[model samples]
Target: MNRSDMNNMAGSPYLLWRVGSLGLLAVVACVLAIRSFSPTARTRQGLMLAWAVAVVAIAASAFVVPEGVSDRALLNRIDPASGVKCATSIFVLSLPIVALLGALMGRAAPTQPRLSALASGIAAGACGAFVFAFCCPFNDPLYVVVWYSVGCAAVAGAARWRLPRRFRL
Candidate 1:
């Protein structure tokens, strides 16, 4: 397919999936940051910082990686279109429920660091899966796992670092 064809393929559904996943990641990261920084005066500020950092990290990674990597013969074995559908479906189905569960559990036990981490991990996994689905036929699964994991970790680390002392449970 030509460049125009590729651009056309990345239309509404793809945009929606990408935007939705990013939004979900932002929400989850914010929640985790808030939980970590509970009782702090700068909780909101910290969350914003975390969000900014996550966006920068994702953007940087995308910019550095060449699109040609996804067009390899082995990578093309998987249907990118179908993969995107699967990933998007998984993300849409999982994020809200996981977010809700995190909120409920967080309210009940605000001091649980492990719980917060688990929530962050779930969000990361969802994002990774979605990215992998869309990037199929053009990238290796291993690359997806590695880069996505790194992206999620960067976000989670930023959230954790910005946590307020009162919320450091």
Candidate 2:
């Protein structure tokens, strides 16, 4: 579609709100995951593994399959053809790297579990934003912040739930 058509597609306020809410959820989930882990070396390792798996899974899903129709409809509000491929690529490349870095940093330092998770989440968000800059160039900033953030959070939450009780916060 033409530029105006693209603009019209992406101008919905509600879509922005939905994406933002999801992003916030992601941040909360990350926090929860970190807190769930025990304050031990093993728990730290577990947390790192959890974040890594979640990031990889979400990023792969973004490309291997179309985002959920509901998600697309929301995204289409910003760009009828959101650059799904680019977004997926960025997510796939950046998330693992960031998670790994966070894991290593956490391992080497005396950071708290919650702090480590939050740090990783922030890194993930930054990577998401970088990916969005190239992929969904026409979409609203809110969409990027929300959907990507939420995706990260979902992974973190799932990891927390799956971990054994001994490792729980």
**TM-score (all chains, Cα) for each model:** 0.34, 0.38
Candidate 1: regions farther than 4 A off: 1-42, 67-80, 83-100, 103-106, 109-169
In candidate 2, position 12 carries an lDDT of 49
Q: How far in Å is the alpha carbon of 152 misplaced in model 1?
A: 11
lDDT of 2 by residue, 1-169 (tens): 1334435545444334333443443454345444433345344554565456445534433332223433556546444244444445445545663555455444443235444454455445444543343334344443454455554454334322332222224
Error of 1 at 154 (Å): 20
lDDT of 1 by residue, 74-125 (tens): 5453445554554454444445444554455456444545435444444544
Best by lDDT: 1
Clashing pairs in 2: 9-77, 10-77, 10-78, 19-146, 26-153, 36-169
The candidate 1 region of ten consecutive residues with least summed lDDT is 158-167
Clashes of 2: 6
After superposition, the stretches of candidate 2 with alpha carbons farther than 4 Å from their true spots are 1-90, 152-169
